[model samples]
Target: MIQKRFGSADTTGRKLDVIGEYLSMYQKALGNTNFETLYIDGFAGSGEVPLAEHTDNLFDEDVRTVIAGSADRALNVDPPFARYIFIDKRRKCIDALKAKFKDSPNAERVNYSIGDANEHIQKICRAEQWRSQRGVILLDPFGSQVRWETIEAVAATKALDLWYLFPAGLGVFRQISNDGTVDQTHEASITRIYGTDAWKTAFFEPSKQTELFGEPVTKEKVVTPESAALFMIERLKRVFEGGVMDEMIPLGKHAYPSYYLLFAWGNASPKAKALANRLSKAAVKATDRKHGRIV
Candidate 1:
């Protein structure tokens, strides 16, 4: 059974719980030797969140429960050799993570980095210690914090399985369509993640119609969260080799916010495919639950 972390239930917490459970199960089914370089949480948050679902009251938060669960599973495996590398931009998040995992037996094996995840990737990848191991990177950026070049660089490593949290609905598409300023930095960020100029075409093309908030949309349409997500998933598929793409929806009645799109790649083995399928199904179930459907 999976251990529950967050006390008060909310959309984000439930979603994290589902992800953690599925990931742990996937690791177990794949067995101990399946991966060498273990987990990577790019947008590693505090192991909890402070805001309650309906209230504005502030409280302590720590969102690293998923990482904690993954670590526990890794340590229980036979070899006990897997390592976790967590990266976060905020020092507060780093401190919170440290406090949350203070008692973890695998804490010593964990590597925590404070700074831009992209800037540190080369250093982490080139380090002699991780050269021989296979990797699974969980990129859960808050918005569009991750760059496309970083994704490409990580892909170049040729031994990575990426589980990305794309900002399709929440960030890129919405901003580009709604905001007039069209900042170079934002454009560059989108290009980096998409790894191509195709997005420009999508934005400018007259015939392309995208759906936003369940409404039929055109090039001039405001970027809906769904379309942005779909756009990212499609582009990511083009760049990454031998990976399955799937979206994760939340479960239960509190599901109005957003969903996750998981990109699984590396080795292209049967195990990878199977894990992708499992995760996809799990995502749907979680989404259903989030919407208050009986699943």
Candidate 2:
């Protein structure tokens, strides 16, 4: 098999570690339940992500290790999920995953698909019998690939917990221009991501200074990159019935926040919500402590 190199940072390992931790806890909590638990990896990449370029900052003592992708971590969970679904847009990625897991003991229990992650996710949510199925989905897209409706679909299931790697610095923060001169394309993408145009008011404000012609310049941005993640959390709470985590585990090099790892539960039941919340919080905290962060 040809090894494909994937870009990663110190926070990449941290993000994967958090996913691994949550899956283990998720399995343990529901392992005895009558409900069939599932693990779904949206935007599932190759089985492993090689970290040759950014190994120095990785938390693990084995600096030369290849980081296990989310799908790999899910399969490693003890008394594994009853079913697994791995979806990726790239044919090569799905092929690689299929090849990597073909000989596994649980290969029969896993399903692989090559297509849009959002489409596959929505189909699953709409088709599933949520009452008898409990699941966790990892949405770690390359950029702003996840649409708002897709998120709504997940929440509608009322049985799946979501770990979303929102592109805070890399996608949302980049789309928003400081001078407020966002192009039509960016405006549309941002609106699609936030599910509303309210972000225009939340992240920007009217500038006191005006152009030479006395016409007001585009609204000046009122928020910084660090605060963007917080804004997203607020938007997520509106759609996720089980609510969202108050804070996100920022994924990037030290002090340079890129991706925001957000957790939201779909289950509306008090007991389910509390368990998911507790486990998710512990997972993030454990990952941070392991990385020597002062969380």
Candidate 3:
């Protein structure tokens, strides 16, 4: 139960906290196994964020707590070999991560690659070694910075389990109303990630009222954000025949603003499903707290 702050506000920090808890619980329940190899962070930040508290707060904890946890598990488990690959475009962030973890016990097992995550994801997947073993990729980007090609490449791995962030707020829905004439670049990216052009059809379809999870909800109707999210998840499931897109971890509905949607995907094992359900419940509770809604 390690805790740390990120931005001056609590939103990002709280989200990270929940994710860390979920990862820890997941690993613990998973028990000792040879689930080794790669633990990747596509948008690994500078490992810390400078913020101020009443007496003047300055430093935050390493943001790569999940990766660190994986490293710890690797060390204590039967097979003590595991690798951590962190990718970030900012030189400062990469350098900071390197400096922070340089003296850590698992330092040698960690590697940092500097570049756009979308650009290098494919190259990493195509590597000779990744073809084998089970690897988990955590693709948490700011918004839509992650490209479809990158997701496609990672999903193509067949052995990689992807936990991704979907843009659900203003970033994605803003473009939903545009009729067929939206920018091709974004559309292309979405298509590649989704592995189909069906979303385009959603854009043209008229809005409608639908029941989601047995609850009546209404929105633009065509290409609901939930559907878009599920679409991508199903594509990943198909790509990884052995895997399944469990369910959406509802981060609850908030009146304020948030940047992205949080979701997880992996081999649809009982453990994975249980972990996802736990995460979903936690997210719902957190969301309820934020919105002053009953949990």
Candidate 4:
């Protein structure tokens, strides 16, 4: 694949590690069952991302420059998935990925398509074949571009586990923290992202009506990034039956709410919580190691 300008983040390794480990366990437990395991990555960038460029300030001392990303790392998981599907909207990214894996033996098992990731997610869920289509979906958008509706569709699938990379600080939270400078476009975006007009309540207190003109004045409060993240996590937990976002793997030590890893699953089976718990702990440990949380 011709190198693209995009590169992996400092936390990329831990995220992929968590996914690989969890999927390995998943495959082991379900391999003998009637279900087929799938590995899917939406926003699967070029197969290889050079970390050297993206994390100079945080991880410049790390030995590796490039790292194997989700699309490639998914293939590396043990007991290999029965199928792999990678989606990206960029034509160059798709073309680069296709050429990268064209000669691999597992090439035949892959399905690459060019389109919007969220639209394809809903399409996949709505057309799901029940037990025949079990999967692990990765939603690592470039930023907070993922629509709330897409998450709703994925939850409806009831057969897939989701590993979502949510942008908290520099993405969604920042976009709305314009110091009371939110315009109509920003309001619309917040509504779309939350899938409701209710997010205004998180930052702004209810409006007060004046007696003189009977005009309403809405006061926007100071919503910290941390609080914003909690709001989102709670919202997702309500949507996903077995969803968990209590503890997350932050991208950096204290980037004042940077990116985070959130996993969601609706499977009622006992293994669901167990897997979530294990991965969450692992993510915390990984984040600690990065942030000097280690003893």
Candidate 5:
């Protein structure tokens, strides 16, 4: 089977490693609990990813290595999740996953969906069965594919923990010019992702020079990529009753800001919230110590 290829092997590997750590912790903590644990991968790629690693081969430039992706990691968690749902918009990816797990002993426990992840995840979150179920949903979108409404749906579940990789640089900061010019389409997209227009004022400020002409006072963007990511975490804290992790891991290649992994617990119980934060934070810190911070 052909494995899916992705760039920034170091960064992507670090993300999956952190997630893998938390998955193990999550299952061990709640494995014997009454809650029916689940694992949902919103952007589940082919079961494994092919990462290019440096090689000393004189003929070949690099060696391609296969590593378990999130779906595979979740499946292998020590006290496995009760159910697994892997969603991908690309039919080929879903097909690949189905083929990979078609003959597994617990294959029946894994559900594969081929369509928009946002729509499918929102539907799952809104289902009534969530009251008796608890799970972790990984929203590792390629860009800003995860809409704000979908996040709200997950928040409402009050059972599923969230591991959202917000596209801070590629999606948000890149769209907002230094002069604070946002086109119609970009404005709508940003608003949809943020669930409000407040980001405009939150990330931008009136230019002192423009006050003189008052009529079309130009706005100057005041947010750096790092600050923009922090803003997103703060916005998330407002919706998640369980609470949001304060230290979001910034992930990018070559020390550039690209994505920020934010963790939030949906369960309102204080103990659950605290445990969730503790495990997720440790996982992030572990990955950072192993790979060094991505700036």
Candidate 6:
């Protein structure tokens, strides 16, 4: 499939490894539940990457060459999923993905599309293939590309599970300032990502900042980067029927949490909670080993 230099942020590999691990675990844990499984990768990049060649290995297995994308990894797992849906915005990525699977015997089971992941995902929710299946959707966007409405749609399905690579530290901490005033566009992005403007309540105090002359000032803001991340997680936990698990923080080579990895599922789903807990535990340990020291 499409191959890129293994040179993105350092935590990129950690994120992929954790996602791959969860996919394998979920398949093994629920494969015999008599339900069809559908795997979705939002922002599925080119099918191949230089994880081994350019960065330290983070996967459970070691490889020195190019590595399989999440889409391919899921396909290789035991108790195969019933269907695979991969969506990427880049046409080249889609073309490469198709080329990678073109000769495969199970190619017919995989579907690739070039478009906004959120839009296509809503379509998946409406498609007959996803109607009765257990959906596992992974969203690994570059920045604030995933919106809360997307998560809402998946949760509305009442049958979908979600894994989000939320750029809490990168997106929220950067845009939400120490002062009450937020960056214009970032305010919208963060509000949409959190699915509510109420998050500002967590960051800013009710008391307003006043001008030197005693005029009405904007609200005062006070919160740490870590707290900002928690706010996002907590807000999302409320949206999913299956609560969002404690976050798995992946460290950037720069020695900080690059993003918060979280999973959420439908309401009143004990199975969803159990599976999410398992995945959360595994991701926590994996992130510790692979990227914790850098932090």
Q: In order, what lDDT does every prediction score?
A: 0.59, 0.83, 0.56, 0.70, 0.85, 0.73
Which ten residues in a row are the worst by lDDT in model 1? 1-10
Cα lDDT tens digits for candidate 2, 179-256: 677788888887887788888888888877666366558578776666777887888888788878886777765566
Taking all chains together, each candidate's TM-score versus the true structure is: 0.72, 0.91, 0.66, 0.82, 0.91, 0.82
Residue 290, candidate 6: alpha-carbon lDDT: 66
Task: After superposing candidate 5 on the true structure, give the runs of residues whose Cα lies further than 4 Å from its correct spot.
Answer: 1-5, 52-62, 208-217, 293-295
Tens digits of per-residue lDDT for model 5 on 203-290? 9888766653345657888987788788888778888899898787777767776888888887889798888988988788788888
Q: Could you list the CA RMSD of all candidates, in the order they appear?
A: 6.9, 3.5, 8.4, 4.6, 2.9, 5.1
Candidate 6 wrongly placed segments (more than 4 Å): 1-10, 50-66, 129-131, 206-220, 283-295
> In model 6, what are the clashing residue pairs, if there are any?
241-266, 241-267, 242-265, 242-266
What is the alpha-carbon lDDT of model 6 when measured against the actual structure? 0.73
- As for candidate 5, its clashing pairs are none
Model 4 segments more than 4 A misplaced: 1-9, 53-64, 205-218, 252-254, 283-295
- The superposed Cα distance between candidate 3 and the true structure at residue 244, in angstroms, equals 4.2
Looking at model 2, residue 10 earns an lDDT score of 67
Model 5, position 210: C-alpha lDDT score:
65
Residue-wise lDDT of candidate 1 within 1-295, one digit each (tens)?
1323322355554555555655555566544653465677676666654433344445634333333333333334444446777787888777877777778777787788999988877566555344457656777666677777777766666566677766665556555754223578777877776777676766554425466568765555444556666777676666566565565442222443344555656545576556666664665476565535432
| Model 3, global lDDT | 0.56
lDDT of 2 at 154: 91
Q: What is the full ranking by lDDT, best candidate first?
A: 5, 2, 6, 4, 1, 3
Worst 10 residues of 6 by lDDT: 1-10
Model 5 alpha-carbon miss at residue 271, Å: 1.9
